[model samples]
Target: MHLLIDQGNSRTKACLYKEGVFTDVVLSELTPTDWLSIKQGLIGSVAAAEQQQQLQSLLPASLAVRWLRSTAQAFGISNSYQQPEKLGVDRWLAILGAAALYPNQSLLVIDAGTAVTMDWLSADGVHAGGWILAGLHTQQRILVSATAQVEAAALSLHPLQPGTSTTAAVAEGAKAAVLGAVQQAIQLRRIERVVLTGGDGAFIQQQLNNNAVLLEPKLIFYGLARFIDNN
Candidate 1:
């Protein structure tokens, strides 16, 4: 079985893929012990070393372990960015997965998690670059931090129409800013297909125009797996 590990800022996701289909999935906070436990059955694995050393150690010596590094190697995508390697692996993987699923079509990928990332890749397999912005909670914290007197309240996913109070205004503003940033990216890139992923994808998807595809959260994982398979 192939183990795919995605170590992000908040959590680590591990998935077992047998043949070409995922068989098991696990999500846990970044902890060495947790990873080691999950590594027991993994024959081969891929991850960022700094975030996956424990898991790597648990694997058999014969098992292959590959670390994902930012690279300029064309994953069949034309990169329009001035510094393509400077892009995050998560973003690259997302775009790669999007392209693999919808090749030769202008596409936009929006991942709404701790941070919202909007990336664009041409159908012709070119990375046209993208943008990133703070998530709802992050944006709320920024507002409260910037203004000591303003109190930030919990953000609700209720469709925002108008703010009824100051706290609601802050929540609405945060949502609007994030959604607006994503919408702007889509417009600027002239993307034809929009794929939404991440924890808050559904919430953000609801706020967006009905032109986006709500993809499985494992879109990046699928992309990474495809990258490994092809390379």
Candidate 2:
């Protein structure tokens, strides 16, 4: 069995794979106890050592673990970025999955979690770099938290129409800004195969009309699994 772990800023995702296929998946708060439970029955695990000590304490001493890092190995894709190591592993894995799934097609992978990241990979297997921006909730919360004038009610994503009140207006505006930024990234890349994943992926996809492919949030885990399989 192979275990894939994605330790993101907000949550930790785990997937158990057997015989080259994913058998089960789970998401948990990045807590010591939760980590320990998920590590049981896994032969090996892969993740970034963001909280290395805490993670080490949770796993059995015999378990083999690997940390993901960007490299020049070119997993069937050409990384055009000047510094491949500077790319985030999460984004790298996501694009890898995109390339593997949609081979011979240009792709735009958008991850809308704590932050929105849009990465481009060409059909010829080239990593064309990407852009990052604040997510909808992140932007709204930052504005409200940084300023005393804004209220929490003003950031709700209710009714799709234009806001009738000041609070609604603020919330709607924030959402629009996030969507606009994502749209602009997709447009600038000019890639039709846009894959959306992350916390707000569904919402973002909805706002994007039919311009993108909405993928499950576990796309990164699948990518990591593919990497392990190929290696």
Candidate 2 Cα outliers beyond 4 Å, as residue runs:
24-50, 153-160, 229-231
lDDT of 1: 0.71
How far residue 154's Cα lies from its native spot in candidate 1, in Å, is 3.1
Clashes of each: 6, 0
Q: What's the lDDT for all of these models? A: 0.71, 0.70
**Which sections of candidate 1 miss by over 4 Å?**
27-63, 209-211, 229-231
How close is each model in CA RMSD to the real structure?
4.5, 4.3
Give the C-alpha miss distance for residue 126 in model 1, angstroms: 1.0
TM-score of each: 0.81, 0.83
